[model samples]
Target: MTNASTGQMTPATSGVLLVLAHPALERSRANRALAKAAKGLSGVTFKDLYEIYPDFVIDIESEQAALSAHDVVALQFPLYWYSTPALMKEWLDLVWLHGFAYGEGGEALKGKKLFVACTTGAGAKAYHAHGYNRFSMDEFLRPLEQTAHLCGMVWEAPFVVHGAAVKDDAALKAEAERYRARVASLLPAKTEA
Candidate 1:
């Protein structure tokens, strides 16, 4: 708990947990690479939510336990309907219990960190004021940010790769590299006073 009380993350930080929730990893490109880069790091836990609960039945207890074990928690998936995939929503609703994630006595996530990495079929230019998506990505993500705040977690700037469907391998690789680094950078202090 010493690390949890300090706001500085050491190389010995507990771990980074990446939760993957894409509907189909076999058909994915960008998400796949991003998840791959995060795999096998000593202090990293890569959990594929969809793969575990394909029918959308999230394990609240297990997930809560996972959350309790990590310093940095990443929610990685494709952008759907301007937010997260349905299973993710279901997962959130079930796993982020009131007394655990947020409530009068809920402090399980206090001082923890949240980071999001997503890809969209509509390129970067589309998620703007007049773009096809009609709103900035950040704007679409307010609910999530507020949720993190409510749970006493710190929200990091999202790492997004728009136009995911058609980006070339090199382009996708570059984005993946950025995603890896960004995820790596999210390892915050081990403890927060």
Candidate 2:
């Protein structure tokens, strides 16, 4: 599959890891439910960054090992200041090192797939230029898109749930179900088994 930003591509593979980094998971109803689904599913690893490294001292080797084990890497978070949360950015900075994720001899992530599952407070209508958010989701995701390309990984289209804050519990549950299906469906067949 071709990345949205760079047009670089990689064939899909098995075993997915959903890296969740929500600063306020306590207040996250939809994301928490979606993460619960991933936890229930066998073979899909849900690594909650905030819970794992509250001090921001990420273990690089361990993080690299996790990346190596999974064919599909999902960056799951709420759009904070139109970008990833602080710890998530720290993950990219610390874990995606020059000789590991990119640069010379950086073949670790080649052929792997990276996807973003993001939440926005505003509805879809507000993402347009004429709307309040003033930019498309794709536009907001350029860093991830280019980063995936540099790492020789395929960037899948993001799975986004807009207007998450005021969504009813029933609606959130249904959205969670759809989120589960979407993540499940996106998994490589071998992993799906």
Q: TM-scores of all models?
A: 0.89, 0.90
- State the lDDT of candidate 1 residue by residue for 1-193, as single tens digits: 3445576563433678888889988999888988898765556788898889988877789888889888778899899888999988898899888999999778888888888888888978888999988899999999899999999998988888888889999998898788777776775544444
Q: Rate residue 161 of model 2 by lDDT.
A: 90
- Tens-place lDDT per residue, model 2, 42-68, is 558789999999999999999998898
- How many clashing pairs per prediction, in order? 13, 0
State the weakest 10-residue window (summed lDDT) of model 1: 1-10
Please identify model 1 stretches exceeding 4 Å from their true place. 1-13, 188-193
Full-model lDDT, candidate 2: 0.88
* Sequence-dependent TM-score of model 1: 0.89
At residue 101, candidate 1 shows an lDDT of 94
The per-model lDDT (C-alpha) reads: 0.84, 0.88
